[model samples]
Target: MSERILALMGPTASGKSSLAERLAERFDGELISVDSVLVYRGLSIGAAKPDYPHHLVHLRDPVDPYTAADFARDAKRCMKEIIARGRRPILVGGSMLYFRALIHGLDDIPSIDPAIRTAIENEAREVGWPALHRELAQVDPASAAQLHPNHSQRICRALEVYRGTGVPLSSWQLGEAISQADQFECIALCTEPRAALHRRIECRLDGMFAEGLIDEVRALMARGDCHSDLPAIRAVGYRQVWAYLQGEVDLPTCREKALVATRQLAKRQLTWLRSWPDLTWMNTDDAGRLIQVDKTAIEPVKTDENNEIAAVEPVWADRIESLMRNF
Candidate 1:
């Protein structure tokens, strides 16, 4: 029998790490972080990476670019290794693209030509992304439907694909099936109540600032690595912090913008997760209690001859429900 891969997904600041840790403890599992931002070395505070070790993968490879393709390859490799060792691999984080790439193979669309890219970049500078997206809609409505109007990078790439190959980007996506060679079952957990999620987002931002987020950005800038061009710097909080450092906005304004961007990201995450057919929703408030319940149910397997048990408990659904009601 093949091993199972449990996926714990939710928006940022949604207690994914806490739930993942408890799940890992319960299932004799090792964690493989699926967050794109957390892949950068110096981004721990903003990315909210857990300190403990349990098969961390796709994180902070200083020498390599952390693209979706890269993540797909590394994640599959790590999963195989974990399964070989008789441990479950629990993939946890909020990078929807990474998750999609892992589950479904990359679209076989050809790479954009450099000349075309330069031309598109020039056009974007003069006309803006909305105009380019309109062009994409005309060329490939399917791809356009999956992308936001303001997603210039994707819009430009879609246009490039049509221009270069004479085939719409949608064509590549139509018949492509998700590979099933890995033989793993994916379970996605979503925590709900939009209003409660919003409050958690706000509080998490406050905590990040309190933990010296601005100073961390300042340090990154001083190293000359924090630029808008870098994917790491483009992360929600980091981008806003960069604006403040460049004198483009004041401190208060930067914080406000960061919070707003974060909220938007969370909304998009929720939307994307809802569209995932295999996803199984979990009540965030009951997470801890579910752990406890599971722990009690499996104490016999966990206890040794000395009668000593593990320190952590399973998170329970009832506890999560209570938390949601209180929130």
Candidate 2:
């Protein structure tokens, strides 16, 4: 039997975790989170992580850095262990970059040079990230489009990659993939309907504030070990709330900014989902529409001897549509 995993992906506030929990129960699978922020130990309410026990959640201190490469390594190990235990591994979250890293593998860029990083940060401190973004547009427009101007960490990394090696980070990805497509035998599940998703975003952000998102940020700050410049602090909701705590913005402005940031995050996630090569787009965001992970969808992904996914009969596609449709 070929190894198979279920990848449940969606934008922030799209009910992915809830659906994943139910799918895990139905399919007898273990859960693996694909989130950048969920790795941070103290980032709970602001990150909007599910209030349940899960692997890969709260794995690191907020001050520590956890790269996509790190996540891919950990995720692959967890998946193998889960499969060995006779259960499927259901990977879940909105971190699309992590998904891509796991599927396609990371590019061979030079390791982080502190001198280069400090130079980029010094430049950012002077003219801000938009100037650096314009510079990236000149060199690597593809990466710039995938990133937001306010995404200082990625923006800095892209620039560092270019400056450190004189090669574009996006260009490196265009080369060969390190992993075979059929090795994971995973099918991505996502949803659409822009207006409905936006509504959910608004409601979720409002609920986050009501649930003491500010207090959570405050607690992390009170720890004194964590700082606003850490990668975890730059996460959508926490960034805005931290600014409010720093007196950089008022409460109303913070709430407004946080909602906008989350909406933008959702939009980027949607872009990634639509671009995914092996995605099965679910028409509805309502988990009730498809209550379980139907096993039939994974059984027919025939692969050639070279381990590439082979073209199967149309019946397989139809079966997937039937089993995964939001009816």
In angstroms, how far off is 74's CA in candidate 1? 0.3
Tell me how many residue pairs clash in candidate 2: 0
lDDT string for model 1 (98-172, tens) is 887777666766776789888988999999988888888888887887677777766877788788889986676
Q: Write the per-residue lDDT of candidate 2 for residues 52-152, one digit (tens) a residue.
A: 55789999988778988899889988887887887877788888888878877777666767899999999999999999998999999999988878788
Best model number under lDDT: 2
RMSD of 2: 6.4
TM-score of each: 0.81, 0.84
Candidate 1 stretches with Cα past 4 Å from truth are 54-64, 170-184, 286-327
Q: Candidates' lDDT values, in order?
A: 0.69, 0.75
Instruction: Judge candidate 2 against the unseen true structure and give its global Cα lDDT, from 0 to 1.
Output: 0.75
